[model samples]
Target: MQSELIHDSDFGRYLEDFKEGMVIRHWPGKTITESDNNLFSLLTMNHHPVHLDQHYASEATHGQVLVVGTLVFSLAVGLTVREISGRAIANLNYSEVLHHSPVFIGDTIYAESQILSVRSSRSKPDRGVIKVKTTVTNQKGEKVLSFLREVLIPKKN
Candidate 1:
């Protein structure tokens, strides 16, 4: 007997669906660990004591070890790539990056992205520009990171 097949829901968005002011909240939150902070800091050549040394970080404002800022930013951007611009032709630029709050170890993070603008490319008829604002929040509902980025995506035929 032959088995039936099932298809999973698609996570990627089509070009026509990229509308201005559209917001998309990504699923699958990730927790930051002490080890994660240390490893990321070491791997990226960021030897900041605030991220690596718990004793030193404990004396800081938050009184605890904080996650590397760049790591959190990278994670937030990575989370939205699949649904927003996994098939992007090119990344144009990034702007208005703000670090609203510190991300501490053991904090779970999730992200949401809002489509700020979309414009058809005059030179490349088959591609278009998409500008989006991404915000990342910690488990305590604190906004840790936010940024605006632009990318080029292929048009749906």
Candidate 2:
């Protein structure tokens, strides 16, 4: 017996879909939870008291447990995966990562990205690279983190 394949829906954009100066705002922001912070911290082998110990963080400058910056960056990247890197062959580089403000456990994070450049690969004509600047903001619209990432995506033939 032969098995039949059902429908397929593509989740990400190809090389030909990107344009310079184009902005993409990701939807449905994620709220940071205490467990989320703790688990991420522990999973990454980061045992900083500020991210785990409530009493310690209460006495710190922020007066609260700060959500790990790396977690925020990861969330930002995840948020863009469906729109930015869904069809990516590889992630080439990540640079200029900057944390601008504090993120707490209850903060809802949102992300937006702007295409900085798109160039076809000279060696491999079937693929291309895209550079984008992503900005992550909190529920209050305050910019919390920003960075640049380059991804290689295949072109539509």
Candidate 3:
């Protein structure tokens, strides 16, 4: 006897589904933690005292250990991946990244994205490029980070 296999998948939006000015708010915001900051800082070899040393950071302007900016960026982007690029061929580039405010441990971060452009690939008929501008904000609605990312999404079969 032979057994059958099944494959079920939920795909991200295709090029035809992206429209200029489309807005998507990612849910289940992530809260920054001391462990998260420390682990990410150490794992990435970003031994910035402000991110790892609480005592050292206390005397700084923020007066507390600041979460690693890249960690915040990575988390914010990851939160949107399922809706933004789950079926992507590849992430092409990240541009115009700006850190508007500092992120601290215990602060919850929420992400939102706007579709900037969607165009067909002149070379690859099965893929298209989708450009989106993303913003990450804290629980208090203060903008912490913003950037643009372009992804190559595969067409739905």
Candidate 4:
């Protein structure tokens, strides 16, 4: 069967679609490279040795270069936007951010998000709060990072 193509703007979803415990796995994982770490660290003005200096990183706990935590977090969030929050009104906040393990160059990362809770906004009848737990894992199925975030989503009229 042929599937119809749905444009981003034309695809609208209701709050009920984001039910609690619903898990959305983002496909086409990204492979982290040496250049990615270096560029991300420099772009963010984070000159930390763990991410920028290979020699220094070799002596650290992991004995290798580490990907910046923020970069991983941003990538995870970016991966979910298309499927989860393409039409979101606003991102409320992030909580429970944890760096469970270090990410190294050449590692592939995949993202999964679980809807945690939802609540109707009192002031905004057309919007509601959607809380989700996002996790980034490597090819080995090891979770390297995770966080909880909430966003305001428009309700179906």
Q: Which lDDT values do the candidates have, in the order given?
A: 0.83, 0.91, 0.86, 0.83
- Kindly list the per-residue Cα lDDT of model 4 for residues 9-57, writing each as its tens digit: 3443567667777777776688988898889999999999989888999
Clashing pairs in 2: none
- TM per candidate comes to 0.90, 0.93, 0.91, 0.88
Candidate 3 residues 1-157, lDDT tens each?
1211212334466777677778887776899888888899989999989998889999999999999889999998898877789878899999999999999999999888888889889998988899999999999999999999999987765
> Candidate 1 residues 24-126, lDDT tens each?
7787788988888888899999998888888998898889888888899888888887778878887789888899998888899988888888998989788
In candidate 3, residue 69 scores what lDDT?
Answer: 88
- TM-score ranking from best candidate downward: 2, 3, 1, 4
Tens digit of lDDT per residue, candidate 2, span 22-122? 88888768999999999999999999999999999999999999999999999999988988899999999999999999999999999888899999998
Give per-residue lDDT, candidate 1, residue 77: 84
TM-score of candidate 3 against the unseen true structure: 0.91
Off by over 4 Å in 4: 1-12
Clash totals for all models, in order?
Answer: 0, 0, 0, 0
Which model scores highest in lDDT?
2
Name the lDDT value of residue 112 in candidate 3: 86
Q: List the residue pairs that clash in candidate 1.
A: none
